[model samples]
Target: MRAPARLREDGPLRATLVAIGLAVFGIAATQFTTLPAFLLEPALQGTPTDASIEARTMLLILNFLGFVLAGGIYLSATDRGWSYVDLRMPTRRGWLYVAAGVVGSVVFFVAVSALVQLLSLPTAESQVMDFVGDDQTMVLVMILIVFFFNAPAEEFLFRNVIQKRLYSAFSRMQAVVAASAVFALVHFPVYTAYADSLGATAISLSVVFGGSIIFGYLYAKTDNLVVPTVAHAAFNAFQFGLLYVALEYDIEEAQPAPSHAIDVVLALC
Candidate 1:
């Protein structure tokens, strides 16, 4: 009873910790569930090109479920009703934030790509392209996933649940930084594959952290998840759309972004 009471009484700090734990569990869940399903898919049998596409698609779906469950259970235990997280479609002002986020993210992405290139840093191939492997059908499906499910779900879990809870535990700046850092660090496992070496990995991770800070800032500043959510969607849509065009045209000249993905898939973990 005492332990349960503490869990109940604990505020943002406790919620944040629990969110992190559940996130780990969620990632583990992917290992057992999504990974195997993808590997054993009859459609992908003898089609190694489809290996990452099917596997990661399932992984994204499961991760969304896990994040939602984590946030939901935390809300229930903390007695913070659904209203505690503001996810309503933003009014006109919120739209401005969303627009800014999209433009800012694009500007940031371009700037970072140039900086990475100049610095001789490693850049990651677009994971979407890596996975779909000339599979047009999967490409279209992933586009839909990116625009609809992946973007909104990640914002709800990370910004609405995790980052928002952190605010109760620290100053807004501190909380945003902490949340953004955790957001960035969680992606460490991905950098190795995206980067060529430790130095390049660091640079790539910095881009992720920087982008998260922007996302976190928007969430914190606007006092709503709407800004970051839409912004994230737009950003992802831009990238995925670009990738689709590149693939369809077989455009070899376009440089893949040096992305240190934030949301596991950089859209959601």
Candidate 2:
């Protein structure tokens, strides 16, 4: 803990490269660790159990860990602590920011839905949501895990580490746009893993890119990662909460039950 500050303090290029390099290696480490279940079936090994559920959940956990590892490496290399990435605990006003952000997130969803409809934007269900489906037990556990792990990791890397550095190196708009673009680009794996069409992937990427811009701007304005982190987690949690609500609602009704949340949401269409 007493190591001297050895890395340079102000080089955006170095910071960006270090962050990205660590992220790539971390992802590869996770992918290698979790590839077996996809390649081998339990029945073939006489296990006679569906390991797919565990496998999928592990992937989410591991990916979150990977992003954390990336942040850890960047911090270590930079000889800085969490504050270097604007991860200070929120003040009273910060809490208010978070509360307001939740409302903004709800508005974001509605606005984006309208945008998609207006543009005829291709859309596809996110695969992460599959791991967080209507199983209440699973959903409850994932909410905390995602709030603490995935949302924090992403905000740390994208806003604190990358955008913070960019802010010092360039104008505010350049910093936010560049950092958000990188944030959105890194999500390409989801496209390959889940999207059925190029148009679907494009729209998904565009939405994520736009969301990243919002998060980046939030972090810039508030000077706290917690604000954006909480907002991002809230948005995701609400999305899942909606699914759970619709599912439970239909399960109560005598009408035909939907297989997934989209079916319930798609009634608008």
Pairs that collide, model 1: 263-266
- TM-scores of all candidate predictions against the true structure: 0.80, 0.73
lDDT by residue for model 2 over 1-269, one digit each (tens)? 12134333446676567546654554554454434644554331222123344554454555566566666676787687755766678998888878877777677667877777788776755543334344555555556655776678767776777777666555667778878777656666656456688888777777777777777777877889999999878876776565566566755321111111122111111
Residue range 6-85, candidate 1, lDDT tens digits? 34465766756765764565455444434455445644334435456656466556545555666677678879879878
Question: Which portions of model 1 show Cα errors greater than 4 Å?
Answer: 1-19, 29-36, 39-48, 51-59, 124-126, 255-269
Where does candidate 2 stray beyond 4 Å?
1-23, 32-49, 52-59, 81-83, 118-120, 129-134, 251-269
Q: Candidate 1, TM-score vs. the true structure? A: 0.80
What does the lDDT come to for candidate 1? 0.66
Please list the C-alpha lDDT of all candidates, in the order they appear: 0.66, 0.61
TM-score of 2: 0.73
Query: Number of clashing residue pairs in every model?
Result: 1, 0
